[model samples]
Target: MPLPGTKSRDAALIAEFRMISGASEKIASSFIKKYKSTEAALDAWYNDPASANGGTSTPNKGQEKKLGEIWEKYKDSSDPKLVKIDGTLAICEELGVDPGSDSVLFCLAADLDSKVTGEWEKEPFVKGLASYPGNIDSLTSLKNYLPALRKKLNTDPTYFKKVYMHTFTLAKGQDFGARTLQLDTALDLWTLFIPPALTSSPSALQRTSDQTPPQFAEEEFDLWIEFMRKKGKAVSKDTWSLLIDFIRSIDKDFKEYDDEGSWPSTIDDFVDFVRTRRSSK
Candidate 1:
């Protein structure tokens, strides 16, 4: 029989949520009581590592390899949604909680990190929801590197990339008519599903991916002199600055490994960086 009292990892969650939210003991206990069912299942899963996919506490070397393993195991899962959401929940559960707010927040971070390349490579952005184009859904969903995108970018670059490209194609300088495309409806159809996610009532920003590091790396961030020539398609000046800022943000993480530099995580961040920087100039 499983251990009594509580599962191993999820036991830690009570503390995590408390720390992040600064919940009072009374509030925390009350919240725990309110969400007892979710907490219990989460803890139980943590107690049994198998409840989380892989059934092992160790991580496979790289994100790419890890993703390959997940695909092999679950591509044929009897329950699809279970594998997708619950699988992710396993991580949050391990982390102490899985708030929908957190999921939506991270997705946004990923887009900003990867420069928002493409949410899906088809119309309507949402993978499976959108008509697949070029036989590829999104970089985030690509077969080989799913885990890598999640690990490295803290977001799914492939999936977001695919949807981003599709959104761009659809919105390429094309203005929407009054009340043409409902904001939430648009995000619902996209790979990332932003509006309903970011705001309780949706924002008007629509779809926009523009980060910078990837471009600099793509262009080798070759001294400021060459930044202009290569940056047109790869990045913009404001994006370049933001990349510089972000690099500073994680200087500690990348410093020990290599003094070179870490890149931004999304296409959206990059695009804005360039535009903002240029406009400022």
Candidate 2:
């Protein structure tokens, strides 16, 4: 009693659900039955208009006005010698926000956009607060606004890792190491991950609610195996065990590799040196 193309459409929908959810065929089939199509399912779950505060698209004008009022009070003074970054940081501090936080960075950037060039500057910064998405006009409203935005954005749990790496390139500080603690604190608020270790205090451990063991990407493990084989070492569980130890050690003393922003760091270089001096049996 099936329609001519019903089987194909159902098959395609099931496949799409599997790809999107990484769920098994049985689970994806259940989802497909309930939603009918991938697009509908995604939209219903992610962009639920009912949950989006009555589907208001633009920033709330009343909140924007409140933010604008605050901006006028804290807009940069006409002192040529005062660094703009310093002024921005001071204003964020007054608002009880971490100046280096991604939320602050995004909100401040939006708040400071210039009308002429759409660049973050003093005048437009005040004007931009009247907008939605990243409005930081008022700390009081932010308590409610941020949660709503987070739901809208569907922010991934691992988003902070990207933020963490991006900061190194974006930040314009010579001694960034000194402010590493601030970065850790700020990133911890936005993402859920137990850092392998904290360089600031080697003994300090950050455990997540799940308390599950750290998960390594398949490619990371592959690279470890490749590196060992290239050095003419026998690939074994012991070798992987050593590499895991190395990874933990690297995380514990990240400051040592903080100078280089590359993944796995100079840990390989150190490993290579040790390998060279080893006596071949």
Candidate 3:
């Protein structure tokens, strides 16, 4: 009744779904049957973004299952504080997110769309977190699932801005600055978030060599100095992150400024705005 290799293919899909959802084989099979193909089914799950429907809704059943699994594991724990705090750390560790102090709490609140009930105080924020059950672990799973959405969206330049904007928002303006993000974590964000955002546009392709210069010349440090001189500012490794965020914003506003059919198509554009033929206004 099934096509050649259909059994193996179906088994593979079941395994992948189980890994992502922690669902039983029956649940995974039921989940996978809704799509014409495994890939299409995965796409539907990932493309659904966060919302306010609480447990009844999410981008996909897999995400809902992840939250359910985490809750089922820890919901009845005797130590609420331990589950609340250490459980967050466990989720962050799995997601490769920073968990210094209670940073995970803030991240969870932001990701879960919890209301900002207090004036930037953790106490009030934590108290208001009641709206989001599964709290820390739920947010972690949501963020963990976002990259799949991001990867799918990256194919369309329009969604590139969405990826970083969503990331920065979830970070709550605290994802940068001195000792804020480790080098490896920063690199991961850059790899996942930067390259897609910086992709040059079709309009930029026709530009001449003189119009677009490299961001780095013989010496990388010298190029950095040139960049500072143009902006009349200096940056340490920590501060450089702020600049990166600024660039992300610029990309969001302009939607591929590189596509403007002009210069400044490369990182070198930031080196000297004046020489890059960009309007200094």
Candidate 4:
């Protein structure tokens, strides 16, 4: 307490910790002292179930009010209660994310329960922020929450699948009645959603002993794209949704692929296409 400059330094650290973890000053100070840094304190706070129950589980009334304020700050100029593309870009900037980043945008959309790509209504926007693990009232808290969200996309297949499927809905833009995704748009999305590897096989793609099972072999993905381009047809909803099942069910060599199965016609045709190409090679 007697240290002159150390008081300000401690206060700054405590403030940063409070912002990130929504901890009170006393709690923040205790964590900071125990962990010796703001980052470490946050790590401890996130891992501690007792602390998390109080601060991180769900936003309290004050945090909900703060979320409303943040929403108003970024609301669309035209709509006042909506967040459009311009507002979304501004929010992305505040969160330290590139507005052009597809993966981050996908994660954000899933987290915020965004119904479409360029627009967010007030109900879902504030509600989703409130549902987030920790209090995210300010840019600092939002920025701090993003890494964990992105990591969930990378590490949890089930969570990634949920987000990936929602991406199709988002990609439809404002068209609720749309049943097909355009060929170019579908291909671009496949490239973004399907994790890529440099090699053609799963074994070769493994960089570590504990790597998760490969989702799409690069060669197989290329063949699918080639077949789609050659067909020159819009991707039907069935085809798009069934592609995930197809990828998970088939062997890399297509030995397990069954044309007689209940797969969409496009998938059946793509299997034939793969076989024809393989025979020619």
**What's the TM-score of each model vs. the native?**
0.21, 0.36, 0.40, 0.73
Most accurate candidate by lDDT: 4
lDDT winner between candidates 1 and 4: 4
TM-score of 4: 0.73
Q: What is candidate 1's lDDT per residue for 39-134, written digit by digit as tens?
A: 343333223333233234433345335434443343225553223344444433533433443332233223323222222111122222111111
RMSD of each: 17.0, 14.3, 10.7, 8.2
Report the poorest 10 consecutive residues by lDDT, candidate 3. Answer: 200-209
Clashing pairs in 3: 215-268
Model 4 per-residue lDDT tens digits across residues 96-181? 78765547678778867888786788777777766655556777876776665554455444556677778888888778899888
lDDT for each residue of candidate 2 in 79-177, tens digit (9 for 90 to 100): 542225555565556555664333435433423432221123433544444443333356654433444332222222233233323333233234433
Specify the poorest-scoring 10-residue window by lDDT in model 2. 198-207
In angstroms, what RMSD does candidate 2 have relative to the true structure? 14.3
Instruction: Locate the minimum summed-lDDT window of 10 residues in model 1.
Output: 127-136
Tell how far residue 167 is off in model 2, in angstroms: 1.4
Query: Model 3: per-residue lDDT, tens digit, 1-281?
Result: 89999889888997886565343466557557767565555444434322222233323445445555554454325553224444555555666776543223333444344332111223333332323322223655346443443344433233443433444444334444433334344334444444442343211111223323223222433333445455543223434333443343332123334434333323435534433433443
**Against the true structure, candidate 1 has what lDDT?**
0.33
